[model samples]
Target: MHGFCMLNCFLSRPDEVTFTAQFDRPGNIGRVHIGKAEIEGYKSKVGSVITSRDFITNSKGGPTWRLKFEICTFPLKGKVRFAFSDSTADARDFDDAIITQQETVRATPEGHENMPENLNNLAIVLLQRFKRTGNLSDIDAAISAFKQAIHLTDEDGLFMPLYLNNLGNAFLARYDRTGDTNDIMASISAYRESKCFDHTSNPFYIQTAIFCYSRPATDYDGYPDDRLVAAQYWVGLSQQHDPSQVLAAYSTAISLVSQVASLSQTIQARYRSLLKVSRLSTSAATVALGLERIDLALEWLERGRGLVWNQLNDLRTPIQVMKPSGADYPPANITEELERVSKALDRAGASRELWLAPSAGTSFTDVRALPGFEGFLKPLIHADMIDHLPASGHVVIINVHEDRCDALALRRGVHELCRISLPDFSYTKAEGLRESLKLYLHASGARTRGDWNATRGMRREGGSGGVVKNILRDLWILVVKPILNPGLCGESKSLTLPEFAISSYIPTFQTLVDRVKKPRKVEPENAGIFMISQPGTPNQSPIPKPERNAAATVNRVINIMENYTCVHFACHANQNTSDALKSGFALYDGQLDLSSIIQKQLVGAELAFLSACQTSTGDESLAEEAVHLAAGMLAAGYRSVVATMWSIQDQYGPKVAEGFYASLIDSESEGLNADGASRALHYAIQNLRKSLGDSESSLVSWVPYVHFGV
Candidate 1:
């Protein structure tokens, strides 16, 4: 009784000792009195102890005395012992001395006797069974299991929301198969309720809410306005979080719409949904604008219409920096990096991550941070472009919205920006005008004088080519003319169209003529050769014949392009919608795509004449985006661009080129400047019109050739 025992226990006990004793007799159990208790190593005295009733163990075959104690030492270890009756007669070991901690256990829900024990497993099995057997009963069983799991889960637990979400999804499936409104409504309610318990910042749940609310709310046919209220509610929920999430959600939604619109393929596939989402963006901006939130309006516009510009900006950066110069070549590493960036941007429409810079508001910082990217192109904001507008010329932006349209106009020297209301210009009218332009061009190209019936079919009063004229006239009157008029500044102005004029500022440019042809000797495959024998001439190479075809030929066009002011491409042009950056002119030794053109800063380039086929045909999927070659050139810094909408007659390319350059060189008296190009193009087309004698074929010859930019 006087001896002490050392024991190891799981409990973290204080060093102060509290001893409990138990004594057992056949008739009764009573507390045992301990003389004294002391922890062997600790100085703290024992506290008072409470004893339990006598417990009998079968191993000992006798009643036993059990004792427990605590000491004030921090290690939570102390000595304790149990004394058993008849211990000396037949010694037996007591295994109950050791106290072990028990872990908390979660209850797993089971299916029926023939099913899985785990609720998740059972739910999955039922879902699969329903899919395989086409039985609604299995889905109902799964839904029930999910609900059971949800109920058993703590209300604030992480798994609870997941269970609820699963239950809602199952309900949605049932609704889809059965066309039951109740099931869908229940599904929406379940999802909404589940959001209350979602404490984590995962955006997937937010995306789920958007999809859930959108189906019955905004996207569904004949859905009630109350559904829209729900959709707005969910959107509000998402907007409550970080703004980055909201931007990503809206960006993803727009991309999805773009994919759908692109898939429609037909020019006439003006999917109302695409228009609807775009109009929603307008509405969002309108609200922000109403609150005088111009910054927010600009953000909204950048998210939508500014999309293509941002993409092009990113695409242009590496190309401009990595472009080879005369006697200089891009190292293998630079070439590889350029190719990688190009591939990433090519698939940007499908990847939202690529669309955004690694850091917000900056474009291509990730790419620019790579080795050998010190001089990479920098990103630009809307204000930068606005500030770059010509002092004399007006920059007009026609914003087509759902309920109304407005024209935003700015000039370089003018401090005040003007907004003009265009009651006649609507989204529907814009689409109609686009369709009409396409239709007239397509139909007019399809027939000659021989096909009178086709001609007659297109000759309705406001139909055929009249639509094109009317659209141009409207654009001029409603959008353009108002911006040009001095009446906004209180200057008296006539309603008649002003004669197209320009300042007498003479801009000079280097004339390049690069057309690849077989040279006298093939170049060495390993020399990394990039040299020009003369300006505007095919570069001479000294590679061996068979190996020349095997070696990587460097493009000289990119090297020489930035050195000049007015560049003209008379080579074969190809458009790659799959990779718009790759859509470019086939130059000597290599191809110069729009990627290169846009990347290369052209502050020196006054005019660009892309005398190639279909130089201005943008990807139809990205029609709202200005992804065309002409636009790329303009974006590259060309104040004026002459591009073709479709393939022109091979013989006509040179004639138009000659006419264009001759007008620029010969018309000094006309005060030929940047604006003079547009007038020159108009007169050039007029000359072509005269040459072709005003026939439908003449329109075909001249119509494809058009002017863009200032």
Candidate 2:
């Protein structure tokens, strides 16, 4: 008796045929024939017949016969007939037949119209095999096939990039095996050539390029700079795709930025490194916001913005002394080691070895394991930020992207987050406003002393001042008004202020008189005023300068900060665009920079009124980072800060200060309300606006005043 089955299959490339057969009798034989051509090397037609005894026993204790045949030795095309036969079968089973393509059969009939595509496909198959088997011959064949395809295809054809990209893959795969620098360079050259294709004309080609580039960009073991370059390439290529794809590319690039500017480097080095990817976070958040993923946008902002400042906060976290009851504290020695590493990390030039220390590795993990510390030293998620919101007021974070502008407001006691869209505001408008304000400042010389004397002539000329007025009005209508909508921030009257007395300590400014008088004079030890002023100027009062050195000036200010409840500055502030840490307030002889103040870490500081030029103006390149003097004050332990977004008019400074102080000090309670700093600034700016025509024209004088923190 005999049993047989036949299947006709088409051959597109070189392939293999495999099947398993089962026989019950010892003398039963199985044979495979392709179009009457029997396979050799197993049981040759001229030799002995293979019986069931020669087959291996399967799991079911039945004899099993497995056969494999390579199609490369046969014809390249056409239907091939496959037949299976079992001899002397009581019952024979033939199962699990599979045809696996091993490689691409070279384009047949020599001058085919689809020859280039066939060669390209052939190269891809070879390249894939090379990757799997690490075979040099297969990669070489792939590279050769790819070059042939490229030579045959038109230069402007869509398939050209595909061929070049495959060639690059072939070269890159070869480089992995041989470690040859030439091969790697060749791979890069191929990829560069592929990118020369016009993305607009063929978006599919661009997407293919993105896929090819993303592989190396996200490779975990790749060099940071190399990965960054690939990631940037991926970002550029992804722009042709949809916004969601573009956002994914930006997400990848932003993540790679941390590797480039890691904490193992010195703070200065990290900042310098980050300058390469300046505004990257804002761009990513903008993309995320465009997709209406407000939570994702916030998360990206929190991850990428203020990175250095956040690192400092983490390093200086007082985890060593934190021994909460019922919590599993780390051993005393572990805590001590963590303290040592934290201090070392905070130093100016922390070495990489400090980061690699064993204690540094395990310290944060152990600390985070303790109760109420799970989020310690980690980037705060949206939920974590909401949980830490102040008890009474809303925290509105505004993000300005080119696609859209939005404000995310987290109100106290509200579990749901509110998103307010500002349709009129855009990144382009903001940039334009910034440029116009800058031009007005430069044309009118409205900096340093905050004097508006130079601006009077320009205002009369009606060029710069009118432009600034319109800019401010636009800011109000487009950005501020939308955010201040009652639905988001609630009514102004509903805001509550934390009770505190500024009469405890006050830093007297140059223009201030007895406008902020103490309700009742206290003992000298309990109440005091410290003044810092530059000499050789008008209204330079009896305030004495202890030392003229910049360091001495910083030390004096820091000492006052340690003792004072509130400090006010009516001096010139210079914002360092290159190094934000160097941005500071100009004092008697020199400048007291932000870095100096932050290093001191003052305690019991209540409020800081920075009534100076550009106190809140951050570096444009580091827009997401709060690297201005106002932010420095907050980081240095001030509960509230009143700062100027631009240069304030010297004449109106005193009036604004008077209004701010008056609004903060309650006559009935005889105390200063620190939490009302935001409200007080609004009150002062409104007063200034009223005095200066109470219209768009007044915006120039009043708009610069801004309040930061509660």
The C-alpha lDDT values of all candidates are: 0.47, 0.58
Q: Model 2 over residues 1-710: C-alpha lDDT tens digits?
A: 23212212111111232323543332222222221122111112212221111222232252121211112211121112111212111111111111111222331335544567656655665565566567788789789988988998889886888888888888888998999999999999999999887346676766678888888888875556567778888877677564446876777788877666665555555666677787677677777776777777777766777666656555555542354322435567656767777666655333443333334657878867877767656655677666555555466677787777888877657878778899988889899988987876666655544445543543554544477657656866676667665565454432222221111111111001111111122233432224344433334322223223233265677676656567777566777765566778766556787767666655445668887778877777777566678766665556567887777666677788889878777333223434566777777777776677634335556767766654
Clashes of each: 15, 0
lDDT of 1 by residue, 1-710 (tens): 21211111101232332333432231111111111111111112112111212122221142222111111110011111212111212111111111100000022113322111235444644554465455897788778877766666667764667778877888898898899999999999999988878665688876676667556444433122234345455456556753434443443343343333331122112222233344545555554454454544544554555244444444444554455532244455545555555545434233332222212223345445656654354323345445555546555555576666776555676656566667766778777777777776666543221123322333444334455556656766665555565554243333323244321210110000000010112122211112222112144212111212222223556766666556666555667654545677654566666656655554455667776667777765555444567766655566667888775654455567668767876664323234367767766776776787534445556767767754
Per-candidate TM-score against the hidden true structure:
0.48, 0.60
lDDT of 1: 0.47
Off by over 4 Å in 1: 1-285, 288-387, 439-466, 473-567, 570-574, 586-592, 596-606, 619-624, 635-639, 646-655, 667-676, 689-706
lDDT agreement of model 2 with the native: 0.58
